[model samples]
Target: MTRLLGFPIADHRRVFIIALPMIISNIAAPLLGLVDTAIIGHLPDAIYLSAVAVGATVIGFIYFLAVFMRMSMTALVAQNFGADDMAAQRHNSINGLFLAALLGVLLILLTPAVLELSWWLMVPAPALQNLASDYISIRLWGAPAALMNLVILGVLLGRQQSRQAMWLVIATNAVNVIVDVWLIVILDWRVQGAAVASAAAEWSSCLLGLFWLRKSLALGWHHLRLNLKQLLVLLRLNGDIFVRSLTLQLCMASMTAYATRYGAIYVAVNAVLMQFLLLISLGLDGIAYAVEALVGQAKGQGRSDRVRHWCRLTLLWSCLFAVAYSLIFIAFGEHIIRLLTDIDSVIDTAGHYLPWLMVLPLIGHWSYYFDGVFIGLAQSRGMRNTMLFAALLGFLPLWWWGQRFENHGLWLALTGFLMMRGVAQAIWLKRHPQTLL
Candidate 1:
């Protein structure tokens, strides 16, 4: 068939064009982490990057945990579209919004505890530690708004309204970039500038997202109601997503904490390395997300043949990208790290590990790719269970065992985590071939 899942190439092209912007916009958010590193790295004080490191790590925990809102919302909305139910789509968005807000408020309140733990973990120079606290506390205020923006974007993507998701991201990041300069250059707010810029942009983005989401859901305003049945459905779907996110964060946090023991420069440079990982993953993520949306829609319509076609096409694309990614990472790893951080020590630390980084694009690509397929299948419980199991059995054990060693241990543990994900998700997918069918 010339067509893809009955939608035709033209239909996919339209979706792809729209999704490109969302990918670009989404890409900018991760840059802020890089920006934090760059700004602090270039500052008169070398310690600034370390400050950003500790603060960014803490805030990252919040963002990573709440990622479920995006994952679940996208899958749910796509399913509703396939079912031809506009009402269900609207309710899912609303439910995501309410939940996002609740989670954000809770994060704001619990930030003090998070801050305390951060201080305990980092015995960096006292000045650096204080800077970290200030940056983290300021950044925490944006939690609610940032989480809401994530939910809104997910909802838009789910609806195949990729253009809108793109525009929202562009506007938000534009704001973030502007404030980042003004506060850092003019107000001379070092770490404060980076933290506040992120928070302000997040809140601004949430406002913009609300405008878009409200316009889309306005028609069903009077009809939208969450009774027991609907509430249970919403919880079940969102809960699976939540569990998956929690497992991911736990696994990642282990990596972060372990990096700290290697020293701040190591952790800071690795932080930059991780940003590269996110950028590469998100670029390819566009394809995986597209596959998920299409596959879910096909499954909704009970078209197993269409599902098969989409999955095969997606795997083909992933294989091609895998080869390309390995080449790029191997060839340009140093140049990319240099562009992000200027510190000699940080650069050297990263260079030593660049070889392993090359391995990630090829060997580690499956985890990110499978995550998309599982989400599309709405096998959140399976994914969540498998991920958490890996974190405990595969990830945590190695990470804990590695702590007694040098950089080798930390590197081993981190690589082991990604490898476990690839192997475990593959095993899980093979056993549940019904998902592909």
Candidate 2:
């Protein structure tokens, strides 16, 4: 009789169980970024750390561009699964892999041009700029493998295998840590080592993901066909995801650019805080992904009752997790930030922002939950439109105010950004309850 969110989680423990591995895996993904920052931040000069920040943040957006494919694949496959069409689900997985490969090539070609433009980005020191160049040039090689990993994880989620997804994350990170040690400490490769390590980890995961995806799809392998009808469905679904992703990535790129206005230290400090924010936000988002798969499939099966139940459990656990974790962070937030970097200035700056950072998760739970629900119901247009408005109306104006007010403006804008995005998306959800499944 105990409540999970608004539902009896006792009967739906499987959904939470399915999301657990993803939660841990999402946590690990951030650890990789943190490790890179820690290693580079501890180097003799601040330039080294700032260089990694510039380079990594730039490429992180690149990595996010592939997110649409991942989200789209998850929605499509989950719907197929709920329809009890194993063949269609398998086909969607394959479609995702092919699409990832195609996009990988496009990203690879865009690299040299991106680097040339990256040079124009407002990095204060030349040393940092060079480091950014080296890191970007080397890491761009992994675009294909990285994108493939996204698809693989999406398919596994569609099939309700979050444990496997988590295991893959663990295995991939192990490779990264080991390789990072060899390159950074052993060979003294510095910032470039971290970049290489990230790419290597993705390639390793892509290999394993291929193996797992193949086995999963082999069940319906015989029914695989690349017909026009399925292609249209995949393209349309993925197209919306792409637009949605572009808007999201633009918001990130804009954030970094806007921060760059305050000079490299602000950008650098923000870069670290953004990593922490991503780690915490996405870690909470693992629950949303759980809701996405469950609700999407439930919709397909016309199991409206189960969809509502899943949403209740997900929202409950996510808010509780956010509150509990944020409290622990409030208690030891600065202590934890200190461990990641020895730079006293950056540490102080990050801590100043840490309290406001805490509110982000709570205010954002609604949007994250709605995103999952909309994806599950394949309501990408609603998701896309709402985010577009948030970024353009909610964030940009707030950022403009931040610029006008000096330093305080950015912090207020960021907080406003989180609050507005969540509220705007909730409004959209109200108009489109079906997206809630």
Highest lDDT among the candidates is held by which one?
2
- lDDT of the structure predicted as candidate 1: 0.76
Instruction: Evaluate residue 327 in candidate 1 and report its C-alpha lDDT on the 0 to 100 scale.
Output: 84
Off by over 4 Å in 2: 1-6, 32-54, 122-134, 181-197, 219-225, 253-256, 260-276, 334-355, 401-404, 435-437
Compose the digit string of candidate 2's lDDT tens values, residues 67-149: 88878888888888888887788777777777788888777888888887777655446766778888888788888888888
lDDT, model 2, position 344: 86
Estimate, for each residue in 301-406, the C-alpha lDDT of model 1 and write its tens digit: 6677877766666666666677787788888889988988899888988898888777777766777677777777777877777777677777778867877776
Best by TM-score: 2
For model 1, the stretches where C-alpha displacement exceeds 4 angstroms are 1-15, 30-53, 123-131, 181-195, 220-224, 259-276, 337-352, 396-413
Error of 1 at 107 (Å): 2.3
TM-score of 2: 0.85
User: Could you tell me the lDDT of residue 115 within candidate 2?
Assistant: 83
Against the hidden reference, what TM-scores do the models get?
Answer: 0.84, 0.85
In angstroms, give how far residue 119 of model 2 lies from its true place.
Answer: 1.9
